[model samples]
Target: MDAFFASVEQLDHPEYRGKPLAVGGNRERGVVAAASYEARKFGVRSAMPSRLAAQKCPNLIFVPPRFDRYKEISRVIRKIFLEFTDLVEPLSLDEAFLDVTNNHFAFPYATQIAKAIRHRIFLETGLTASAGISYNKFLAKVASDLNKPNGQAVIPPEKAEAFLEKLPIEKFFGIGKVTAEKMKALGIHCGRDLKAYSLVFLTRRFGKSGRHYYDIVRGIHESEVKPDRIRKSLGVENTFEKDLLTSSSVAETLTNKILPEFFRRLQQSQTAGRTLTLKIKYNDFTVHTRSRTFPEAIPPGSMEALALELIRQEELSGPVRLLGISLSNLIRPDDPGRQLRFSY
Candidate 1:
């Protein structure tokens, strides 16, 4: 999908087609969920403050998000993907990773499959899409974005390295603003620059993601697109629209805000963890995380303790826009004693 949420709005509203339009964030409290191409021309972008976007383009139209309709379109697009390969791993409601090593339609190539799918999407939903096909996830993700608005790009295995070489490090999916800035400061501005650093060096800087960066620069990624990527660590976090003046006030309110999520998930899993993690997504959306592992595993009943500990830690920091918690290093029910009342 390309410009998915906005495109869906355009498809359903004739007057919105080819007009500067956006979905989500029509209010002071909201952010841009998606921006149409016309909106993009005016410097409007996703995750930007909706108020600022309006200020940037006084004529920009902001439509309220319609998740139900988007979900319906997602289902329709998913069906199109399944026609070619059941090995489809949905990354979000609008995008997916498809393994077409052996496609059902027997399309001559992945480009053909991409074209057919795009065509079917237009025919069925009157919406445009773009696609990228490659031997692995990293290149494929890059390829998908190379062309836009019903376009397709394919990176053969032989050319993968060269293709990635010229790509900007910022365009690497996992590297957000903070990480990109860090890479730039280290004199890594693009794919070629990334490859200059040793794996040990990248790992030393990026922890677990360093290995991934090391392999992807040379187009040597083998990470599979798992259809069943479990909810390994369920958690919630927030990003505030404006800066907070105090930390303790936000800390006092965070549990009331975030603890419900844990309580809700505890209905489904054992909820044990060896670590209590804290993540803060600042006003600028630059995220920083802190974690403390415990000697005793976080019991399923420790949601309160976990929440309080996180709040205390956060109170000592400055204003925070987001708070997050996850029960890591979990042990399944069959191997452990029940410590809390749980549904599953």
Candidate 2:
């Protein structure tokens, strides 16, 4: 789906069509969920503070998020994907990876399937979508975004190298700001530069992620498209609009701000964690994490207790830009080696 939340709002309200609209919470604490291309021109973007977004686009119309409606449309779009193949791995509500190697569709090639899928999406949901088609998951995933708003981009085997060569390292899946900067400093700004390094070197430098970077650079991804993906954790965090500079101010957030999020998710999942982790992300995007294990198992009452206890152990020596707690000691067999993977 293209501009999924904003498109849904526009579909439901004709007045918002082709206008600079934003779909998100309409509060100072809220961030943009999606921004129309019209809004993007003014430096508006997803995750931008709502108040800051308002300053960027003075006339930007904010549409409150309709999660229920978005979920319904997501189901509709996923249904269309299943029509072609069962090998569909949904990435959030708007994006998915479809494997058509042994597909039932009559389409002669991946590009044709992409075009048809885009057409079906627009016809069914009354919205546009962009698609990427390639021989492997890595290339295909990147191809999908090359074109946007009812467009398709296919990276045939011949063009795959050239396509990835010029692509920025950040554009690759799972690579974020911190890793991108690290890679850039190492003279790796794109796939071509990354290819010059050996897997052992990348692995030594970046741990497990180096292996992925090594293979993806050569267009040799072998990851499977999962269907019954179980969520292992449910969490929420806070990024203060202004810096939290004092211990008292930080303590207030653990009790008054962060603990509620853990409790809410704990209640919803009927699960709790014995290990608690505290994540403090600075304005520069640098992060410090601390975790601790407890003897008592997690219960509904213990969720907030664990968060507060974790907060108590933490030393807020400087200003905090973000504060987060995670209850991740979920004991599920499907998740392997998790018992030893305590975050705190």
Per-candidate TM-scores read 0.77, 0.80
Candidate 1 lDDT over 140-213, as tens digits, reads: 99888888877988899999888778889999877899999999999999999999999999999999999989
The superposed Cα distance between candidate 1 and the true structure at residue 12, in angstroms, equals 2.6
Alpha-carbon error at 326 in model 1, in Å? 5.8
lDDT (tens digit, per residue) of candidate 2 on 1-344: 77888888989999998789998745455679899888888998898878889988888999888888999999999999999888898889999988887788666787778878888888898889998888888888888778886788888888878877888999997798899999999999998999999989999999999999988887878888887666656667777778788767776887887777667656666554567778887655568887777764455555566566666676765678788877665655444544322222
**Distance from true location, Cα of 14 in model 2, Å:** 2.8
Per-candidate RMSD, Å? 4.1, 4.5
Q: Positional deviation of 176 in candidate 1, in angstroms? A: 2.7
Per-residue lDDT value at 221 in model 1:
79
